[model samples]
Target: MAQIDYIYSAHSAYAYLGALRLYEICKAHDVVLRHKPVLLSPVVEAAGGLPFAQRSQAHVDYFFGREIERWAEWRDLPVISCRPTFHDNPLELPNGVIITAQEAGLDADAVSFAILQAHWRDDADIADHQTLHALMEGLGLDADALLEVALSPDVQEIHRRNTEEAMEVPVFGSPTYVLDDDPFYGQDRLDMLERALSKPFAASNWSNPPVDIKAGS
Candidate 1:
């Protein structure tokens, strides 16, 4: 079976924006979508991207703020006008839940989408046990069983491994879809991704900047 590796953070707004469309494409093409939830900060830093706090106000206002609004409208998905209330909270629990769901052979896609929607659309605190329990229960999953395993060292180790793999894959940021080892970095590239699924793109001949050249030299 052909597979597309989905590498993204649990609380990512862009992931929420592309969640449904991505699933739809997977279903249409009969593709196996593997959800690999990751730690957003380390992945961003590894890819030479600035952390949210370190970025300039203008950049933040445009990309994280206005860009998100535009994409939400484009995707026809509801999103909070501002960042979620617990947007900065630790991701271990939420990320772990998705991992656990996958490991348990459950409906991981539904589990992941529910958490992403809750964070981006409803402003739920994903880090809180009660909130996570409610989310699991809402899906008819065993909230207690999932939460207990989600916090276990084993599940956390898997989360760590997923983050490491994302770094190794050189994933730029959230919502990267890897098909045949070619990475489509953001939700904005989903159209290209869909096309590639039917007709694989030419092999990459990617190049980097000259090491000696600085920006605007």
Candidate 2:
């Protein structure tokens, strides 16, 4: 089975948009999907991308507003708001839960989708420990046990390692699917990713620009 490294973030709207479809695609193709939750703000910034809150209102309205609305409708998913009430909350707790759940042999994707739903559809706060526990229990996970591992030093270190790896790959944004070392960034590129799985696409022709000694002078 082909394996995909899903460099993900819990609070990402695009991640939520692509979650179910990715799952379906993986199932259809007999692929194994590994979810890696990380700190998104730094990853986006390191990739020379703008944080959503820092973007212009026009950009936000177009992408986060219209684009999200259209995709949600197309995907037949419910998104109560473009910007959730706790959208900007700290992600450590939620991200940690996902990592720990996967470590515990639970359905991390299901848990991840539930977290995304609670935030985007239900306007719930995932930053709260109590909320995370309730979500884990609702998913039939051992809430107390997972929480213990979720907050452990090793798991925390794994989260940090994930962030570093995301930066190393230089994943431009959330929901990036890397298959056979080829990165398909954005939910929009999912089709191309699927096609690539059938027959690998030709390598990109991008080459580093030559050093311009006098360019900075």
Candidate 3:
């Protein structure tokens, strides 16, 4: 069976936007989806992208603001107009919860989507233990047992490793889908991703001019 490595963060807006459709695509294609949650900041930094705070107002407004609104409408996913109150809160807790579910034979995908929806739709703080517990319990999972393991060093280590591997993949942003080692970065690429399920794209012969050598220099 074909597998797609779903590398994303629990709080990523784009990931939330693409969540359900991604599940649909996987089901339609009979592809196995591996949910690999990570700390998004480090991965974004490693990819040479600016932190949210460091980004210019224009950059943030368009990409993080307007773009999100447009995509939410496009994807038919409801999202809070403003950023979540706890958007900058630490992500280890939520990311670990997803990993814990995966490791503990729980429904990690459902857990992942629930977290994403809560954060995006309801502005829930995923970093909060109570919020996580409620989210898990809502899924009919053993909240206490899951939270205990989710916060453990063993599960957090998996989250750490996920971030490391994403950096190695050099992921450009959240919601990267890796098929046969080729990365389709961002939810916007899902259509291409679906197409590739039937017809893989040609091998990459990608190249870029040396930075020191300017165009028309």
> Per-residue lDDT of 1-217 in model 3, one digit per residue for the tens?
9999999999999999998899999999999999999888889999878888998999989999999999999988899989899999998899888998998888888999999999999999999999999999999999999889887989988888999999999998999999999999999999999999999999989998666534554
Q: Positional deviation of 124 in candidate 2, in angstroms?
A: 0.7
Per-residue lDDT tens digits for candidate 2, residues 87-172, read 88998889998998888778999999989888878889988889888988998888899888887898889899999999989999
Candidate 2 contains a number of clashing pairs equal to: 0
Write model 1 residue lDDT over 152-204, tens digit each, in one string: 99999999999999898898889899998889999999999999989999997
Q: Who is ahead in TM-score, 1 or 2?
A: 1
Cα error, residue 186 of model 3, in Å, equals 0.6
Would you list the clashing residue pairs of candidate 2? none
Model 2 off-target regions past 4 Å? 208-217
Once superposed on the true structure, which residue ranges of model 3 sit more than 4 Å away at CA?
Answer: 213-217
- Model 2 C-alpha lDDT versus the unseen true structure: 0.88
Residue 1 Cα positional deviation in candidate 2, in Å, after optimal superposition = 2.2
TM-score of each: 0.96, 0.93, 0.95
User: How many clashes show up per model?
Assistant: 0, 0, 0
